[model samples]
Target: MSISLLMAVYNPIEYDGRVKRSANALAEICNIKVICPAQDFSSDCFNPDAFDVMRVLSPKIKIQALKQIFFWVNFIFQAIKLRPSIIYAHDYYLIFPAWLAAFMTNAYLVYDAHELIIPNQGERISKRDNFFYFLESRFIKSADLVIAANQERANIMGEHYELKKIPLVVRNIPPMPKQTLSDKLVFRLYEKLEHEYQEDIHIIYMGDINLDRGIGDLINSLKYLPMRYKCILIGGGPSESLIKLSHSQDIIGKRLRLLGPVPHNHIPDLLRQGDIGFLSYSMVGRNNIYCAPNKIYEYAQSGLPIISTSQEPIVSILRKYKIGELLPIKDKNTPLKIAEYIKKISFSNEYKHAIRKFLLDNPHKSEMDKLKDAINGVIN
Candidate 1:
């Protein structure tokens, strides 16, 4: 007998790697159904037969806050109608509504928190964050189960909520299927560069480009780097302006290649073209240190060494795995230090292949199984 599980997610079906993996895993034991935003509904990962996706019209630019309001109103009603065995909420905003739906239908409630939403030391916590924290705490206190993306965040949630048990840590990692780089893709990225950059070391930073994500720092630091060291930023965000600024500059202009946002499915192939992956989030708060971003896995999967700031968990992972070096964050000299570090390292094709194998082998399906079991354990 198959049980019914309802997943309420805010993102489109095409992306959301974490949700896609979780849904596929849950489908093994449940009749999986998804309620997601109608925009960008095309998906490459999901099997249409195994799951049914209900599309809801998401609010556009106007009255953006009302979007959540509209979604919850629709979600709670749908949850009640579906009467699923479980209501899995992907965002904190949906937690309260999912809890209410679970209460109304006697279904298990699961909250999947991807980050440390609460502010850490030295960071400003606005009234809006406070209000959401109140709702998040309420859900943590009342929900049948809560899952954080990392162990540190799980501990933080437990301490802050004063809960008897810590939330389970289910990190947002991609599946390890040993993907092969396409022959055509081997030179497409290099073809974008001018003849001068044919010999440059192609450093890439592929993800959300924003202030907190250290895009400004990454671009500005390139000025100190050698002319032969080039950077390709392969993502878009509110910080597109920063990229424009870098593009307009005379000194670092030619070296910086800003590309449009690549879809999640094509990211791995794109990442394979880079010499190194850059990850440098400004550490204004513990969230930056405690959180684990998907790029770490993506970089390793691409067999690219990383030039990253010493963020916790990420730092530990890098050091343990020996995949890359942490860029020393000394002010005024950080760029020079990064340049120096990159210049010193060398990797051969043999070593690159080994790194890719290590990445694929390191914590594969077993970790995902543990995550799947954590959710199913709630029913037991």
Candidate 2:
């Protein structure tokens, strides 16, 4: 039976590891239809053929309320036109529309909760969110199946509702490619960086560089590092101001590279040259504490030693593998401590080999299999 997948996300085409992987995996089992919002209505990134396997389109709308209304109307109209056997909503924004559409069409509704919607991190739960949470509770009771990105999220749902809902844990882990870049391309990229600072130990940071992401601490920590190590801040967010702070400190001229944002495909090759990887988001909320970010797996896949804050799942994994350093978030000399830690890890062959082996052995295969089975069972 064919299944329609509805997602409410910002940019679906850019190589967001989780979204792309999930979309591709779903397409393997069913006729997938992804509906998302478009920043620019004319952008061709939403072209269905670009993904090669699914039908993707932007339900063009400007405001949030209007978007929600249009989405349900369009989804119901499309359900009648396409005749999908089941409907799946990826996150909260798509939930109401999918729920209404499924009810009208008598189709099974699958809700994929990538994060905790009500008590989310970084944003306060306002009256609007509380009201939505009440509706979300009802929707969960009504959904055919519920999928969460991690165990912590599943537990959150269990705390609030008591339905016969089976929560499937579908982690946002990326598949690591076995092949490395060609020597020629690596050399070319290395040469570009070499032109700037030949002696600097390059450290790489990717993903949203927001305030909660600990970019400020990371920049401040740079002062504690030895003169030979330089930091590269990739991706965009509030870190742009931190980049400026680095400049005022005279570190930006030679010791810092702020490449605002790059394409996701370019990240692997970019990571290859870096001596270390960093994922240092602040653990201020339940979502932050429980996050098993894609970057953690990405760093492992890239064979780079990671430096992260001692958050729950990340600290647990880092300590378990002994491949990365989990430092206290509020240490006064955090930058120096991190620098020293990096220096130690950079020279350790044993740690490097062990991490690479662990990544290869795990490879997120079991997680993907479980998710595939759960989705298949629900849709069937």
Candidate 3:
């Protein structure tokens, strides 16, 4: 039996590195295919060799409604062609199309809830958002099996739907490969950065660069630190405006470098060059609070101690494992507290040892086993 994963994305090229790793790992055990709709742009970054890549040709529509219709039309056409035993929809938007196809083809439908799709009713939800939530809840409750990114997200969905079995929590963790950076590649990157800027401690952030990602706070915090501290913003989002603002604020040009969106595979080498890795998001919603971001695990695997906010499972993991430090997201002195924590960890061998041990352990083996069981459950 084969499984097809349908994923809705802004940039289909920007496959979550952890998800790709998990997909590749899962492919080792099962026949798997990935189906994604065409976005405004395309890239060769996706690994065509790992899984069959099925792309639906749809015109780029700015309106969300039109985009949804276009995607569904192409998805239905493709689904008819590749009749897999099971269909796994990555997010709510992809679920409706998969449901339509499943009904016609009589295939098992699986909902992979990566985030809290239903918006808080109390908050201002647009009419379109409300309709999507209604469809999501109905289809999710109807799916043969459900998969959630974290326990908290599963709980939220359970509150709204009557699901007999609890959705399986598949934590987004990176597969730890026993590989080392070649000294030549390491030294070359080091020399390149050194030539561009002074030899200083390079702190790296490698995910979406949005307002809620705390980029402003990060840049503000840098102002309080010494000139020896440098930051490399290695992703793209609405917050690229902060780059110009950083320059206008007279934050050292050499200290803050914005290398716009590098390919996902290239991130590990970048993380290796950094003194510390950072993952901070404002806990504005339940989704943000419960996020088990891929970068956190990547940082841990790279043996870099992290500075993060007191969010859900991440905060619990950091505190319990003694692997990193967490600051209050809303605290007025958050930037200062983060800076102090960085200073402490940078100088402490104990913290470094904790991070090293965490990496050496590679705690995601059990999580991957759980994922494997979930996939098997759907098939068997």
Candidate 4:
């Protein structure tokens, strides 16, 4: 049977590992066509031969609110034209429009809740979040299937929406590496580290470099750490604050090197060179508290022991796997605590063993299987 799956996301599908992974996995059982905002769409983002791509062009609306309104409407109209067997909404922003398109097309609607729309921890929900929540609560039950990144978020959504079933958990793990870090790559990395940074203990933070992800804390922690301890922040975001913080701490380039964003393909190799993986998301918002970040899986996959904030799903993973240390992100002392923990855990063999065990048990293939099974059950 030939099945055509249509996926719609407000963000570019290429940079989103969850959507890309889902698209790639669904291709195993069906034809795939992805719909994304045309403003920043790149053909190089995905292999055109594997699946189809459609970019939604928005009218030039000067007002930001009006622009977004046009974008989603265009997105919905585009999805309807394809007449896919499954209409997969990647985020809450697209949930209602996707529902509408699916209803018009008579397609099986799948709502993938990447994060909790409601603020769980009493953080003020913005007008935009409020709107998305409205869309989600209204049409969520109409979905034939719902997916979440982790079980905790799935339970929250199911209870919040009063759904008959909890959303399926599809983790955002990368595909298993075909090869470990090449000796040449390691040698080149070490040569630079040893020569420039005088190489002691490397703390690596990959993904969005922003205050929300605790980049500020990480930067502050560097001052408390010895000169031998250095941090390499990968990825790109608002860097003015981060740059100023690093400079004020007197660690910019000297101890903390912001390499900006690298291509996703280079992450595994680059991350493998690090001594410790840093995963810190501020616990101010419900989404942050319940976040099942892909960086944890990426860090473990690269064989680095982690030092992370104490948050749900993350705390559970670390505690269960015994792969890393978790600290509460609550006061000024937090950075000092992170620095001390890094010193204690650096080059430890125990965490390495735990990471190996974790990798052996969990792979992206299994997560892909879970996603495939869930969708197949609905479509078949």
Q: Give Cα distance to truth, residue 320, candidate 4, Å.
A: 1.1
Candidate 2 lDDT over residue span 1-380, tens digit each: 34555443334545455666766676666666665544443433534442332323445556766656665566667766665667777667667777887887788888877667656545667787776777787677788888887776787777667756548778777887554566467557554344245566777888787756776666776787777777777787766577667777888757777777665666777777777898877666666777768887878787888888887778767777887888886788777777777788767776687787668666677777776788778766
Two-way lDDT contest, 1 vs 3, winner:
1
lDDT of 4: 0.81
- Highest lDDT model number: 4
Q: Model 1: residues >4 Å from true position, as ranges?
A: 40-49, 59-61, 121-123, 177-181, 185-198, 239-253, 347-361
Compared with the true structure, what per-residue lDDT tens digits does model 3 show for residues 276-311? 888887676677877868777888887788888778
Each candidate structure's TM-score, on Cα atoms with residue i matched to residue i, is 0.88, 0.86, 0.88, 0.91
lDDT of 2 at 214: 72
Model 3, position 278: C-alpha lDDT score? 84
- For each candidate, the alpha-carbon lDDT, in order, equals 0.75, 0.70, 0.72, 0.81
Top-TM-score structure, candidate number:
4
Candidates 2 and 3 compared: the better one by TM-score is: 3
| Residue range with the least summed lDDT across 10 consecutive positions in model 3 | 5-14
lDDT of 4 by residue, 258-281 (tens): 777666666777776688999888
| lDDT, candidate 3, at 351 | 66
Candidate 3 residue 375 C-alpha distance from true site, Å: 2.2
Q: Which regions of candidate 4 fall more than 4 Å away from where they truly are? A: 39-44, 121-123, 178-199, 329-331
